[model samples]
Target chain A: MSLAKRIIPCLDVNAGRVVKGINFLGLKDAGDPVEIAKRYDEQGADEVTFLDITASSEDRGLILPIIEQVSSQVFIPLTVGGGVRQVEDIRTLLNVGADKVSINTAAILNPQLIFEASQKFGSQCIVVAIDAKRAATPSGYGVFTHGGRKETGLDAVEWALSCYQLGAGELLITSMDRDGTKSGFDLELTKKISESVGIPIIASGGVGSLQDLVDGIKLGGADAVLAASIFHYGEYTVREAKTYLRDHGVEVRL
Target chain B: MSEIVIVDYGMGNLRSVEKALQQVAPLQSIKVTSDPQLIRTADRVVFPGQGAMPDCMRELKQLGLTEVLLEVANNKPFLGICLGLQMLFEHSEEGNTHALGVFKGDVVRFNEAQLFDECGSRLKIPHMGWNQVEQSMEHPLWKSISNQSRFYFVHSYYVREKEAIASGISRYPESFTCAVARDNIFAVQFHPEKSAASGLTLLENFVQWKP
Candidate 1:
């Protein structure tokens, strides 16, 4: 009866195959993106994200075919990120059935691209992903690019506000310091950006336990939570996460 | 063996809708086109849209689809999704544009102040993700779907209208009309193609529905 908080299972795909060292029981093909996405859909995941971790531009084309296959089988909103640089990339992904495209480095490098893409493709399909790290800035966080390798010296909160004003429908805020560490999400960073934007924010990066998911919504003020390793490695199913969120009275779809 | 046409005014994701229909009715002829000839001859029509209402209306007029869509929606078994539903009304608060006036209503944006849940937490705009739809009335599309099925929704504005046409209602903070039905038309604010199994079931029912 209410708009439930979303739990998104992110698949770190590399060169057309799902990578992230996922080890699911009874999953015959671990690397298949379509099969993996379907599994998440069955687990009642609100949405599925495929972050193409492929480094090279040439290999980046590989994710297109994978998205084409997954969007056909998995009847859920599919968001594709990683290596999304130009407006052409967003168009191609949407043509192949990507429900949304997350722009990270391209957004920081050319903020106009967000405005143009959102205008052409509609802001509903445009997601601005910000990789933020703890910095000595006034907002306490700095925007990072190149998969958190380079700092842009821009205050994360200010950048988030600009992205929204630039017509970004949603923001995918990731904590670089907490990512892969499994400690927890940067609740402070997430809250700052969430409060700054009128649009929805997805708290990403560090999610060690189900409590982290609830905290992202309850404490961090995120509309949704995204995680990789936890769901990838079968440590927790998306269903388990939603159930846990429901137990915590977060109003999940479960 | 019937032809199902998806009216594409060059806005949202039509491929997903086509793919979803192909999955449900593999043998059925489904075409995505802006050409009125293709749409006019089709047995069914799916009006799918996203983006600003002004853009959608401008495109529909540019393509000369305003009358064609009105004709089809009146006679054929028409299905509208998201902006498609909004455009069926008289006007939209989005872009402050005039719509088709197929139904007696207006599209309004969610109030920022009234978006708090019972827990007092503020709800996000666009109202993205899965939300439970409470069926307000019985229809052919609700043949196999349950009463309170979760559907994938992503929108900022909703329809404000009389209760006579409201078929399904979902809540962000309070109950709002999320679906409308009258005669041959069935419009929804949620994307059934992206609503998982229950959504597929609804589409299948639509494909098999004789009415």
Candidate 2:
């Protein structure tokens, strides 16, 4: 039998600590990433993903010590993203014990980079991240890159399909419009891309309650669900999320 | 003082297992040990695993644990979790790996297409979460546990037993075996340590169970 569903808590690292904000405004420091990750691991999170929101803009390498500290503390899988533009960056992340490396703006600029990285480290090691926002001009959503600063005018659903074809083993799709709003996930957006791709899809953004997570999986058709504010500010824990999912008939690691 | 020896094969979640067992039994009685002699002398043993099945089985053989594990399975209470449960199967489709052959049949990955059809919904891979189990109440390990309670699970592959060895089953897009038991050997695909109160109670029952 296949394993149950997983509850994942995402941490956005700006300057070595967890931070959260609506529409990326009024950034507030949550806590140390390592400490927060350890708590989630203790609460039974299947895995944790860390996004260095400022690493690319700052032109600095990944915070290796932080990654090392967290990896040593938690036994579950860890995924690192942001400022990961080249194959060497992926190598560095993996060497630091990150189970997977997620690429966003860099992969958009060089689509073939996905194929090359997958070939070097295997497909399972590569994750393609797509940030999307609703566009008024086209009356639909388009892909956004570079921390949601650049709009590609490309359809979000189509971009996901292309990323998979380019050898991305997994996809992390975050809705910029819905992010931090806590209204609920963009189920329509998640469903569109999920239906078009075969690889694992991690639905992110606008998660206010446990029902949002279950709705994302059952209605949006996502494989895994990722939340930031709910987990970061202690609105609920990984254990509570899993229990809620279990009660709702959604499979999750208890 | 009944002692429970958790085999440390240098892979997977070791601390969580230790913590869960401690919550169920006395912390003094649960010891995470890599020493084969300690495991052989323990009243019960737990084999926990993550990652690929072949690598884990190889490490067990390299540490000369195959014979020790078989002896424990034959004479003592043996519990397997996740990849630990897969290792007890005959073989695994992952990397074409061969298992301990303790239970007949092979471990295989979930066919996503088939699962979607069965559940009428898109199913994700690497199933992770707290899920409900359809279990037989007669099993000692499940004593006092109701049918509505859930357990934590994280795995991508499952066992396909030749004959019925399962004592409990869970539905995830499709019905699948969640727990298996035969003779003195018992295994659960879910992680009791991660599962919270219901899971902790299951472990406590196992600690006090006398077959």
Candidate 3:
């Protein structure tokens, strides 16, 4: 079992441009999605994800041209999310070369969409992106929907298990509480979900440094670690993060 | 320029495979098509697939491509990727579907009941990432690449064969066939296009291979 842990750099795109923000709040332009993704591919990133931060709020499909550009330039797998509502939407994205389509709010509204999409495509291509935050209630963490604004009063870990059972091949658990904070991944949040699900878990949100990446895998048991602000802001290169993780005994593609 | 048609049965992501081929052999004529004659007569055929076995078989049958693909696989220089490798078997537990049966094998799901060793390192299903691939036997595709070179893989099911057709083996939770080779046909359970430079070299070798 030599499956090396993955290091993915996420690009938060809005209106066709990559943007950055703290904790998913104030948004600012980062760079072009294609250029950043291409750089990461050269840097030996395992995969790249693009989240359309405003597509659902604006009620439109994300920038297909941008996805086209990124997919054409980047050889690695590309997963695109945000505003992906239906099976048709997933087909459209896959047609345009997006390797996988992620669903957040829509999956919450219609849990069957995950099964349908996974059935239509393969489970390997279906990724259920869970935006979760610490809840004040007994469940401890709540699943957030519609770009982290609306909260579904469901236990985050339970939702993850159900999503996997419904054929979601992987789970991208984003800690809304730690998103953009650079405090590192919400290890506790990541650990809880990773322990609950059998599918691969991509620990997302609150990644500030390379150590945070290693911690996501070692401490939280994540199969992959995703970051936006740290990689987007040029605080660290994908190469540097991969090197650090490799040096720390984490198997990463150099 | 050699004619290389990457069979497109509407099953998996074909672009990365298409692009990787273009990058390694820019002068070759590569087309992603379901056209029978094009695939049957191409100098090289890349049967790349992802998704469910039933869906792939269904699309192949629906598109009237099963025979054409079989003809190409047996006669031409062929490379199958992931589900492409599985579909060559007799059956797959996924969707409980019959396959092309080009190879005498069956596909089974990962044994998750006891997914861990005594050391307590649990193996995840879908086996998603770069894992070391040990060369099982010498082949032209292993040229210029080391024996234990890692390739990217994303699969829940794997191929099990009785014969020594496996040219490369990888241990996910156990030793499973990662690659297979026979005269004129080669199949792999990993995505060579996504396996970085080493993968590129394999594709290049395939392009230049005579056998």
Candidate 4:
């Protein structure tokens, strides 16, 4: 039996609504997070990630209701990230039916939070997201926080190793350099981190085509591939991506 | 319609399981609870959990569910998922935790040395993501789900059955028991709620299954 790779469709939500391309051609409501998540589920997405990009504290509570609504209807794993600063945030998300919580800045600020959160909630639910950019550091990729606007000066590979050691169940590695470029995932960055750690790695950032998803697993050595624009703007269905990956000899859950 | 009570010892997310059940058995009442009395009164018991085995055992004890779960598993139609499956065995390699010993097996962690496929590529631990399960025995829960259907799995340790109770097996570079069944008990190493259609089919079968 083969372990099929996963395809996750990420939804950048703001104020409890899906952001990043609010003007999709066919969606009844582009901003409805639940509708978008349900659509992804219907498309056979392995998992759906909701990145809360809300800027204000009052808007932060918006994601909870959205997650609760989605989890009730969509029968799949939902991972919520963005603005997860403490253990309470993780708890709040999990309680509302989020299967996993991704911690980025808070994890860098207090690596112990990873340890504590993992110890308390089990590492399976704690995902550490690393935004890496091409740099002149020893590992050649430096970790960036605050939505890739702030550089932590931490070597991406070294930091990945430490995070695994600190009890992160999985790592979501995103390359800031190729994030919006749509060229493809930074194969070098994903390969280095995947080879260094024993946990599963989710390759994110740049995904312009179906071939990029294949490369994320085959060449980049990622266990899962996350894409937004590729599936967001009605460019490609999640099924099409999986079908391409399967034809290209990559195991997917289609 | 019978009520299905999901044991919640504060382990992992149960809403997904509860919601999935609601989808399949809309008429049946499904409850996510830690109350021993509520669990004992249910027609079917769902033991769902995640995290470290030691911590799970501690929480089960703290909630005084060790005896309650054992009693229900022996007497009623019980469904276990993930850690719920692992906790049925006699012992687990994780933190050297002792399980409920409902079945004759040992929960062992996957050996790092043997985690390589035919291509000689090393496999990651936790065995995260979707994997195909080869049916090993006949069971009602396998209804409508084709043999060797893919299911979502995310765990480091697996069951090494000392008896012939393994109902399904999956290979993570090496073959391991991913499902077990005996009498009224059905347990799986993967999450049916997160495994898409085939997984939902399994849960649907469980809802209508007599055993």
Candidate 5:
């Protein structure tokens, strides 16, 4: 039987605090990651994702102490990303109770990293993250690396398939055009990758309401959904999001 | 003094349950424990849940609390919330996972056709909201709780009425069972703690409830 889709609350950490923005602009202090993660955990989130946006650019390790502290306090599965560029980085995060590690800029710069990490740690432990914006040309979406500022010539959908081929178990696709807009998810982008790949797809960016989450799963074919603004601002709790998905016929753990 | 012991399986929301219970019965003693012996001796036992049913079941079996829990359910006060409640069923459609079999039938997904109306309008999944609970019985556990009082719910799969041991129904798109009871065993589809004051009252009643 198919399991219910998961509603994940994303925490974009900068200097140990959670933050959110639109198209990665206009950043605001959300809260402490530990406190926010605990709140989501209590509200019945299937999983929690922490993206260290600043750590990636600085070429430093993730805030392992924060991850350890949060993991120790929270019981559900945790996925960490941002600045996770090396196999050793994956090892450290996993050792500290992170269930999975997501890679974006590193994967683009070195495609073999995905395969190598997956081979050493199993595909389930590795997640290939892709950030995209609507392409200027008619070919396809433009793949964005380095926190959605640098544009890669590669097509978004094609890159996702390549990651899967290289043994990546999951794909977390965020639409730069839709990030933090709360308008809704990039359904076209989500559906394209979901339909093209066998691995689970986590649709991120632009979730404004409960309907947006349901649409991401039903219309976009996403296996899970990730959002920041709606949840961070208390528009709806994670439990409410899951209940909405269930009533709409998505298989999720309550 | 009333003492409630929350079983620690390392898979669900243990702290929230403890905090909610404390608020409900301020004078009541509450302890979170993984030791099988402590659970066996506690006056009351609560099973809180999250994550996969199979993993929870496995953890319970590993800790050897499975038998102790079953014994307690047969003769003592027991409460299960959310996934904790679902685990009391015979099975769940998730991953072919088997439950404690305390209640009959398997927890399955809601009918997709009924999710939406003929016009293609559908209710969301996970059923996350503050919805009203329609009590099936005047069970003491719901003392001070009224018909219109809303409780918090966050579940994708629910127990159908036919297979339910005792049922309290709620409506999202349509009515479905949100709470279940069998002798000393009680389960709630919604989280009373997260439901604010109303939830705290329910937890208080559970604490004060004497078999």
Candidate 6:
């Protein structure tokens, strides 16, 4: 059988708790990270990613305890991201049980951090997260840092290509415009990046319904689709998403 | 309840394997250690692998668990996952590194040009995701699990071995060895912990297996 398209439930963590919100604003507490992860594992999530939104001023090490707790309870591929500034963070996360770590601001600050991280820990465990917003210019997307507060003037597609060449195994591209819109995924942005890179592209942001997930793979050509609200708010279960995708001939593991 | 020691040579996270074993067989005691002495006495041994072959071998040797690992694998009910399955082989093309030589073969990387599907769509490497596994031979590990059940996989290299020795098989572009079984040893390329229900069921069977 062909490798099935993956469905990942992203857990946004802050101050040792999993948090969620619309468009990365107005944060609301979900449940314990471990409990939520276990529930998603039982729900047949292909993988789980935790993004720590804790402010850097507070010691970032707070996420380690949460990682151990979640890794102990959930038996699946787990990825942790948000404030990974150095290679030690990657080592610490993987040591405690995270399969991979996503680096955004750090990668932007020091592009070589991507190459160095991949060298220390194989590329499979290094995921470069690019937060891209529509550039003011007509056609391309620009990279944003500090949680989409500042524009880096880097083209999303071009930056993604550079990340791939730097040994980043996977690219998690989030469309700031489409995030939390509950409208649909940024198919054009995802498709453009997916077509340019040889490595897998995980399309994230804006998944309101099952069809949105389906269109992500079929139209956007994403290797995996990451969603938050639909699964977190009880809008739909992971099984429901997989079953819907399978029924639509998308080949999800059902 | 029995002791299940997961040999961790510091290659990657052994927590998933240890936690999954706990989930599937809650009564059993699971330990993740590189202590050779503990491995020799464990009721069941899990050899979990991750990262690259060169680094994995370096740690396994540097930690001096090779003898104990071989001893348990030969007599104990040993289960290997992903890199664990690859490490048992003689060598890997990843870094031109020599393996434990538990199984006679080589682990080679997937050639991209040869990965075209029937429709000419190129499949990605690392084979990352879930896919249906076809059982090539009967085995107790498949107990309560369907024949063509989907399992999670994430790897760029694969083991090349005789189909006769393979307990299960799956394909991506083409067929390569996805599972191997012989006597007390059963190894798979896919992750049971991440495979959901059928995966948990297989782990449950392994815990109860008597070799």
Instruction: Count clashes in each candidate, considering only residues at least 3 apart in sequence or on different chains.
Output: 0, 15, 2, 0, 22, 0
Clash pairs for candidate 1:
none
lDDT of each: 0.91, 0.78, 0.85, 0.91, 0.76, 0.86
lDDT of 6 by residue, B47-105 (tens): 98888899999998899988888888899999999999999899899999998888888
How well does each candidate reproduce the native contacts, as fnat? 0.87, 0.16, 0.62, 0.78, 0.00, 0.61
Q: What lDDT does model 2 reach?
A: 0.78
Which digits, one per residue and each the tens of the lDDT, describe model 1 over residues A1-254?
58888889898888888878877788898888888888888898889999999988889899999989988898999999999889999999999999999999988999999999999988899999999999988899999987689989999999999999999999999999999999999999999888888899999998999999988899999999999889888899999998889888888887
Model 2 lDDT at residue A23? 28
Predicted complexes: DockQ each: 0.83, 0.14, 0.65, 0.78, 0.04, 0.61
Q: Which stretches of candidate 3 lie above 4 Å from their native place?
A: A21-30, A55-62, A136-138, B117-121
Ten contiguous residues with the weakest lDDT in model 1 chain A: A16-25
- Stretches > 4 Å off in candidate 1: none
For residues A117-225, write the lDDT of model 6, one tens digit per residue: 9877788889999988889633488898876789988889899989999989899999998888999999999998888887888999888899999999988989999
Please, what are the lDDT tens digits per residue for candidate 1 over residues B73-129?
Answer: 889999999999999999999889999999988999999877787877677777888
Q: Give the per-residue lDDT of model 2 (tens digit) for B52-90.
A: 676788889888898988789888888888888889888
**Candidate whose TM-score is highest:** 1
Q: Which stretches of candidate 6 lie over 4 Å from their true place?
A: A21-30, A136-139
Instruction: Compute the lDDT of residue A236 as modeled in candidate 3.
Output: 80
- Candidate 5 chain A has its poorest 10 consecutive residues by lDDT at A21-30
- Deviation from native of the Cα of residue B180 in model 2, angstroms: 0.9
Model 6 pairs whose backbones collide: none
Expressed as tens digits, the lDDT of each residue in A120-214 for candidate 4 is: 88888999999999888998999997767888989999999999999999999999999989999999999999999999999999899999998
Q: Give the TM-score (0 to 1) of chain B in model 4.
A: 0.98
**Candidate 6 chain A, poorest ten consecutive residues by summed lDDT:** A21-30
lDDT of 3 by residue, B36-108 (tens): 9899789999999988888899999999999998888888999999999999999999989999999998999
* B35: Cα error in model 2, Å: 3.8
